[model samples]
Structure formats: C-alpha cells, structure tokens
Target: MSSSAAGRPDDPVAALAELTEAQRQQAMRRWRLLRPHLEDGVAITRLAAATDASPRTLHRWLTAYRNDGLAGLARRPRADKGRRHFPADLRLLIEGLALREPRASIATVARQAAAVARDQGWPIPSYATVYDIVRRIDPAMATLALDGEKRYRDVFDLVHRRQAERPNQIWQADHTQLDLWVITPAGRPARPWLTVIQDDHSRAIAGYAVNLGAPTALTTALTLRQAIWRKSDPGWHVCGIPEIFHVDHGSDFTSLHLEQVMADLRIRPVFSLPGRPRGRGKVERIFGTVNQMCLSQLPGYAPRGTRDRAGRAQLTLAELDTAIGTFIRTIYNHSPHGETGVPPQQRWESASFIPRMPDSLEQLDLLLLTIAKPRKIHPDGIHFQGLRYLDPILAAYVGDSVVIRYDPRDMAEIRIFHTGHFLCRAICPDLANHTISLKDITAARNARRRDLRAQLRDRASVVDRLIEAHQVPDPMPLPPPAAPAEAPPVRRLKRYREE
Candidate 1:
C-alpha cells in the first residue's frame, strides 16, 4: 500500500468515489475503544489501563476522532466537503439565551429559539443542535442552568469569588414552620414556629428557638444570645462580631430590637431586598432542604390548623420542639452541604479568619441589646399591640420619654425602667389583635378551660372503662344494705350483753 493509502489517503476524488476504502481505519479503531468507556459503569482508569494509554490522551483522541472521523483525524482533506463549523448567528443566539435566561432548560431555550426563528423567518435549530452550539461556544455557560435556580444578584455577588473563610464572618438566619405539633406547658396545642441562625462558614446552627406563634425580635434575640454563648468560651472577649448578619426582611429581623442587638454586638445586620430570597440564598436553600428532607418526612406531622381543613392529627408543642432540636443539631448541621462540599461543623472549625470575641459580659450585653422604640400610651393606659405597660418607677416620667426593654413576643408587658428604677407591670388583652383595653380574656380563659376539659375527659373515660371491665354496679345498693344491717344487729347484741 502506498504511504497516502496507509496514512493520509491522498486521492480526494477517488477517496470520495470509493467511500469506506479510502478513509483512515486507525481513527475508527480509536473511537470504538473510547465510546464504550464513556458509559455509566465503565471506569476511565480501567479503560486506560486496558488500552495502555493515559486517561487524558484517550479522552483527547476520543473527542477528536468522534467529531471528525478517520479522514479528518488523519489530517487529510475530504473530497466533497469543506471544514465543519457552527453558523455564527446560531452560536450568538445560543449564547444570548444562556445569558438572558439562566434558569431556562435546554429544551425550553431551543423552543424559544425556534419560535424566534419562525417569527423572524430564519432557519431554526433543534434543541440538540442548540445544545451543541452552546457547548462549542462556551461549555461553562451550559452548566449555568444546572445550578437549580438563579440566586439573588447581591448574594451571588458576595459568594461568587470567595468561600466562607471563618465562623461569625457571615451568619444566615431564617424562619421555618416546623412539622411537629406541640402541646404547650399550659396544655394548649402550639404550632411552634422555628427560627434558626446558621453560621455560613461552619454550617453550624448557632442558635434556634421554637415559639407558639410567628418569630419575634425577642425570640430572635434570645436565640442569638444562646448561640453566641455556645460558640464563645467563658472568658473569650466578644468584641468584633460577625461582619455580616444576613437575613430576609421579615418583621422580626427588621424590628428595632433586632437592629439594636446586632449594633450592640458590633455585628452588621444585612437585609435582603423585599421579595428577593436570593439575597439570603444560603438560608433559603437550607429552608428548602429542611422542609423537604426533614419536616415533611416526619411522621404524625400536621399542617397548621388554619391551613388544614381536614383536622388531621397534630404533634403537640413539646413534641415538635424536641423534633426540631434533634433535626437542627443532629441532622441539618452535621449533614454535608451540596455547595460547600463539607459538613457545617467542619467548615466552622476550619474558618480561621473570623473576628475576635468581645472582652466582658457587660460589653457583650451592651453589644447585643438595643434601645426599645417609643410609643405613646393610649387612653386605656396601653401601648402598641395592646400591651398595657405601667411603671411605678416611670410615674414621674409617665407621658414622658422612658426607655422600655421588651421582648417582641410579649408586647402585652413592657419592661419599663427610667433612671434605673423598676416599674409596675401592666397586662394587655391580646397583642395579636392589637386591642389594648378590649381585654378579650375570653379566648385565653376558654383555651385554658378547653385544655382542662380535655384532660378531665381523658381521665373520666379511662375510669369508666375500668368500672365497666370490673362489672361494678352503679350504687352497689342491695349488697351495701345487707352489710349495714348485719353490722347494726351485731353491735346491738354486744351492747345488750354488756348491760
């Protein structure tokens, strides 16, 4: 065989005319060896070992040989055709679609491109064709859609360049509805909401709380206090707090109490834009995972009464709190995060770049607490959210500016102190409705009564079952009468003998 036939196959017209015979066979052999190893079970290392070829070399040969075939691989000219290339216009369209619609699926983009082509009277490409064009232009662009959903512009900007370097550098906080129902210590069914603060670097839950209603600044503050206490040593000075405390613009997070706490701690509380969850993407993603993997999977979990028309069985407040505590500490924090590729605990320990802890408990407390906002007392001597706040200490300052340190959850009772004197406490009727003097204590009383009734009913039913099982008569009338008569007769006989 001539060198041309052995290697390049020179006679272009003859090669085209005599099809298969003129094409280089070696390239075909290389492709056959490469293609089978691209499958799921086939290990690249095993394939490379078998072929006596490095994995990289095998991969390069596979790619080249598959795309161009034997003649192109041999660096020979094809008799009938010029070099293959994706049309420039189509390539530009694919790139544009990838950039504009970050979340659009490949199929959707292809369909969109087809529609655009139909509207503009241009040639349309199939979905596969569009995918190929995208891959050829920029492979990284094609992977953009695989990132689940596009993140918020701000959050994406922050995390795009660097990984979380240390604990307390960035903390992500969010609220989630727990699946468990809990019976409060007061015996009321409490659908406790859970708010968690997760250290972005450590993936550790710094603090968490379960409450009967929506999260409040007080609840958040308490949770933060616990988290800070746990993370720091007894004497470690906690001065410079987290650089960024990222949270959604929820009422609790935006409240004066929360802002004050962050300011006191020297931590900057960063708010995501309203309605944009991407700004707190880490926490949002965590919420998704917690709901799907843990909360929804829990047995006996019920929807909130307001949402569940079917009146399903519910876990009591105590039960729910227990479940949440376990899940956060045991499962959620320890589990590996998909993005970070490490467990949260591991990340936290490895984060060496966090700021120093503050000096004293007094300084820490000052760093954590913020001044309460001012509100005028109503004619009923109640404040915002129908909280009746009175301070005997504040009597001189009544109708005047006085500092109140109050928990957001218990707006009914404000902690009033003026010039460092304690005040008399006042009670608000219902903070939920913000009706101060209405004092609709009916619901509170009824709730208590209902709980008591439930317990009594349960006890009575058990007693009733026991009586029925023993076949005990309602009054034991006849037997009791006979026993009483015998005892009287015996006593009378003994008295007569003594006389």
Candidate 2:
C-alpha cells in the first residue's frame, strides 16, 4: 500500500454526474456569471446589475466557489426545508385529518382546523401550511390510512423480483387477450388470447399458443407442452423443464392437471399471491413489447378503445399466428433485451448447458396434454362429447374405466390410458377425415341448441295462438258429463305367505 498505489480522492468538480439537471444548470449559470470577474477582473457591482442578482449574493457565491470548488456553486437546499413549527397535538391532528378516509382537500382541512384552533385558543394553520404538512406525510402511511393496506403494499412494499441463475432454472407463463382482432373460421371477427412461456434468465420465449378463445387449463397445458419439447425452429434453442414455474393465480395456472404435470416433471410451481401481479412483471413486460412492436404493424390492430375494430379485421387467425411466430423468431429473439443487454437467444445459449428433456415426445404429451377425462368404454366404443371414438383395442377394454388425453387443436383422435399405461389412440369415425377443434365442437353444439330453443318457442307461440282463437270460455261446464260407469271389483289373491 504505497502512496502511488493508493486511489486518489474524487474531485468534486469532475463528479458532475452526481448532480441533478437543475443543480447542474444552476452551477453552470453561477460559474458563467462569475467567470467574467474571475478571469478578466470585472467588478461585482457591474456584474450584479447585468445579471439582476445583487452584489452581496455574487460575493457569497464567489467565496463558496473558492472554498468548496464547483459543487458549492449550486443552489443550496434549506436546512429546515421540511420541518414545521407547530405544536405536537396540532401536527398530529392535521395529519390525522389528511389520512382520514374520504380524504379532505387542503382548503377544507385548513378551514376545519382553523375553526378548531379558534375554539381551543391555538394558532391557525394557513392553506399553504396545511398543504405542506399533507405533502410531507409519508406516502406509504397516507395510502395505508386512506386507500387501504393492499394499495400500500402494491405501491410501497419491496418486491423480491425472481432471478434465475441459469437458462433452464426458472420459467414464467401468462395469458393475455391480444389487442388485435382477427377473422375466425366462421368468417366472424374475434379477439384471440395468447399464452406464452419464457425462460426467466434469458428473457427468451420458449413457446406460445394463439387461439380465438379464452385461455383455459388446456391452453396452458398445450403451451407448456410446446415449451418443454425441443422446437423445430433452429433459432429457438430454449427447451427443457424448469426448476421453478412462476405464474399468477389464474385458474388455468392453478389447475389440478397442471399441478400434477409439474409434480411429475419435478418442476416447482410458484404462484404469485392473489391480486399481486408484481411477481409476474418479467413475463407481463413481454406482452406489451409484442403489442407495440409486432401487432401494431398488422391489420386489425385494435388496441383498447378502437372504434369498429371488428370491421377492420382482415387477417385470419392462422395468418396472425404465423405473423406472431415470425416476429418472435426474427425480431424479438434476435433483438438485444434492455435488461439483459444481449439477444435472448444468445444469452440462452451462452451458458452452454444441456437442457433437461423428457425421455420422448410421447411421454411429454402424456404429462402435458390439456385435459384427462375418465371414460368407460361402451359396447360400441368410447363416447365423449357426443362423439363416439373407436379402436380395435377398445373392444377388450369395454366396461372398464380409462383416462383419455387429446389435443384440443385436433379432436379426431385421442390417446387412451388404462391403469396408468398407454393403451391406444382411438379415432372418431365422424371426425377422422377432417380436423375439428374442441372449440368448434362446443360452438356448433351451442348454435344447434340455440336454434332448437328458438324453434320450440316459435311453435309453442303458434299453438297458444291457435288454442286462444278456438276457445269458448263459457262452455267449460260440460266436462262434468264425461264420468264413466263403475265395474265390479275382483277377489283379492294373496301372492305371498307369512313364511
């Protein structure tokens, strides 16, 4: 530790970065004003007249500059800036009124306070004084007392933001109803929900799903399944099971199916506390980015409060999905992230660690498929959702309960599991030739039911009209003449003995 090796103390003049913009501007102004006098020996009285500042103020600034360097030239804050000269009880009273529910305005508080002061023989506080006192009260304290504890925590409480040590250590998933409207298969415009799962460490999207329906447990499972398996795209390298899966307290995220999947895969599920979204901030941020950078450029980009957004829709859901996928792979994945300062793909790969993968795609599907419904094989086949599924092996499993898992995107075939073992894929003969989604089936079923109900109501209305038109209310007494003659009773026979 020789003198040469010792670090030099920081120069206050050189530490301009530490000063705020206002302070820096003030300091520069003072230096410029005083430079003429210091460099060229100009008189302070003349400088003061030209700059509108008094000679005495200029002399003080000069003295400070010489004694403490450039930092001393900035405007000095008052030592008693926030302190109030009020009695303890009066101070507490003012703060109490300010913190009360249905918060009073400064004028109202001052007026009420003045009346109290007059009655108690105390000094009355002015509006400015009341406003100052209110402003000085701790914001967290005011919010808790006025708004609620929840608001206080959301605004003031420290959020322990999660950080993954490695690429596959943690992941976050969330669903957002995309701002864009797209044309559905029925030729109707509808908004789609997007579910995304991203690697927490690299901020790279692992997988995403887009659909023209509200996100459900099945959507979450499908997204998770896609995220866990290795992607076909060469650029998307993020894969494997995460040690912790962070999500909000959404029903889809908290589903029993997802819980079982995470348990079996050795992944811990971390749910944010109810009404606290700060824990999922990392994943939430990407939604905004996608909306701003990607969807904003596409057709039917109806953000919040867009007029006639449905009519503007031109792209189909499939087209929007493809566009989103392209944007993710080309722009978002390759672009440098603000927080990480590296492209997500690059950062994910920088670790050079092999992602932990499931044994096979079939095994992953078994765990990650959307819904597991228990169905008993009938003599004909397995009946599900008004559709019959048939397989040669189902004949042997007739009258036995088995679990079936299927992708909602394609309901033509379902993988059957009996006794926790993979049985066989059973296909619906009606849906074998073409693909139909669970949503489509549900929509069609609802439409049919609505049509039937409407027809029934119409027919009932017609029948009521016909009966009303042909009725004669005064002739109803004739019904008494319709009684028939009574017949003889037969002998009773004891069918059983007392034995």
Candidate 3:
C-alpha cells in the first residue's frame, strides 16, 4: 500500500502512520507480499525484479505468511531485546541512589552503580543506560520513597467527585480558618475559624459557627445541631438529618461524642480517607465563596497577612457571628448557584417529606453537647466546673448521679439527664438568666475582690479620721440637756397634783 493510503484518517491503516520508520518498513514489506495474492495472478519473477529481491527470499516470505499470516511477515525481534548488558541489580541500586536524601548527581549515581557492579564482578552499564533507568522512575513512587506518603498524596493523589441523589440525602461538614480577622473578647485582632455544613445536592449552607477558638468537636457538633434542627429563620429551611454526613478524617470528626450523635440520629457518617479529600469539594467551594463574597467586604478582612486591611478589626466575636449568619440567610441561600441553576433554599425546600428530627431541642442538645458528665445531685443542686446548679426536679434525684449537658459558652443553666433520659434544666442561683462564661466568672471574682479591697480601705480611712478627731476634741456642754429635762418634770408634777 502507498504511504498516503496508509495515513487515511478513518482507515485501520492510519495506525501504521504512527509507527517508527523501521516498523513502517516491515508493514510495507508485508503489504507488498500480500497484495499480489489478492490481485490477479502475477508473476513472482516480475514481483521479485520490481522489489529488487531474490526469488528464494520471496519464496521464504510467502511460506512464512502462509504459516503465521501478517505476524509471520513482520520483522522478528532480536533475541536479546530486553536483556541488560550490565548487572541486573544495578538499575535497582541506581533508582535507590536517585531517591536518597540530599540527592546526588547523575554522574555520582553512575559512579556508585559502577562501584557496586565492580564489587559484584558484573558488567557496568553505560552513562546513557543508567540515566534512562533513573529518569523512568514513576514520580509518585519516587516521591514516596524520598519524602513520605503525605507529600506524594498531596502532589499526585486523585480527588473524588460525588453527586448526591437528592437534597438532604447527603451533606458535607468541614472547618476552615477564614482569611478574616475579628476582634476577640480580649479586644485583639485575631483570625477566626468557621465550621460549616452544606447540603451536597443543592449546595445550600445548612449551618455554620464563627468562633475565635480553633476548630474542635464541640464546634463541629454545634454546627451540626443548627443544621439538623429547625431554624428560627423561616428563610433558611434546610434543616434535616442527612442520610449521609460527609466529613474529613479529622480528630474532631472522629470524636466519640460526634459519633454517638450520628448514631442516635441514624445519620451515616462517611469520612473521607485521611490525607485524601476527594469527597469534600462542595464544602470547600462554599468556604471559598464565604472568603470571596462575604468576608472580603468586611472591615477586618485578612486575606494574606495578619493586618492586611487598613482599618482595625471593629466587630467582636458575637458581632462577626451575627454578620455571617445574616449573610448565609439573606445572601447565600437566596442567590442563584452556578451549578444548581436555582437558589439553594428553593431547591432544598422543593421536596415535601418531613425530616427526621429529635423529639425536641432538649433531646437534640443531649445528643450533640460534648460536655456531659455524671455529677451527683447534692441537696443544694449539681455542682459543675466550680458552679452550683439547681432545679426543682433535682430535688427528686438528690444524691443520685445524673448526667448534665451544657454549652461551654453559657454556664447559667445545664440540661439534666437521668439514666439517659432528659429531666429538666438546672440553674445556678448566682448566674440565673445570665450568660456567664468561665472567663466572665473569673473576671467577676477579680472585680469583687477589688471592690472589697476598696471598701476596706475606705473603712480604714474613716476609722483613722475618727481617731484623729477624737484625739483632741472639745467636750460638748452638758447643761443644755439638764435644762430641757427640768422643764418637762415641772409640768408633769403639776398635772399629777391635779389628778
């Protein structure tokens, strides 16, 4: 066949065009030998003369074709095609040298390979052969051999893409340290961490928590609590127990408390493989949106450096949280999503079935709160973290060890659970109706001590002043008191005589 004919785009012969020169020569030879038989009977002598081949060689080619077909006509590989001229173990040693720490040069590797070959009394490979072997090592394998699995995975691992079947069927939760700074309770600029839960199908943000502390299981649970329970804001209607909860293999995700909560709710917890995040792409995108859209407009947006914004961080932790909540409800949920082509809120609410929920907010709190501990109810009440907790219901369980669950932010009241059943809320008489944190308690104690010291100082000053005034005081005249008593006695004696 002609070369142009072999290079036709739609023909099987097109593959021959991709072959090297030697392979093309062999394929052409086979085609020439087979072409004559497919056509009218042609003289072998004429074919031999046209091809400049001897008749004996043509006969041999025909015989080989009849025996092995096209494969027989193709050129045979040499006997020593893959046999290494140098020591067989030398290639492995070269790869090892290439992967060693403080990597050596190719020349150094060649020299080392030669040394090993000399010691073993085997043939040494040429520089080109050694270089080829070293260059052909798989990059990921080489990275693993040199560095560690984490580096290799981060550089070369494949990410997973998941599509949930329906809204509320699958949800992803993760935490990210936002590129924004907010004022902490201590009045200092600090970057805050955000824990968010998003529905995979609709891309709706179900719940999130903005806090000054690092991400922990407590934060994760709180985010999930808001996600699963009914929202006070009717606009954000994505609350439900997800069929599958996707999260990274973080320590917080693996906490026993979180695991128990998932089990109680019958929500399957699906953890992405450690060091591999094929499943967390959706939530990661949401985090990016928050940084680009919402936080970038905030006053203390810290994109790259600590104080990137010109103005100081003005919003406190609570205020920043409120801002984020407002954004998620008003802007993000209502805005059209690129992938879903509709608002996340509408997509999640399109379905009609009721979501699986805890019996009440108290039941949900008991399952999700991580601060549950068995404390015996004293006659006064339950004492937790140095605060006294009291409730009328606790009078029934006095001296009995009952479990109390509470939010770390609020020490005013705790939810009581007796033998896995929720009892009632216990209030601290001092902290009643007050949201007092441990730091708040400590601050109040310090202020009280300071006030007591000030009062004692004032009393000391009064005592000193009185002592000073009495040290050299003029005695008041006693005659004025005696004159007043004598007038009254004279009037009383006249009245008594009349009677």
Would you list the C-alpha lDDT of every candidate in the order shown?
Answer: 0.60, 0.85, 0.79
lDDT of 2: 0.85
The TM-scores, one per candidate, come to 0.48, 0.71, 0.60
Position 115, candidate 3: lDDT: 88
lDDT for each residue of candidate 1 in 420-485, tens digit (9 for 90 to 100): 554545544454334433234444445556777999999999999998899946675555444444
Clashing pairs in 3: 160-278
Better of 1 and 3 by lDDT: 3
Model 3, position 119, has a per-residue lDDT of: 90
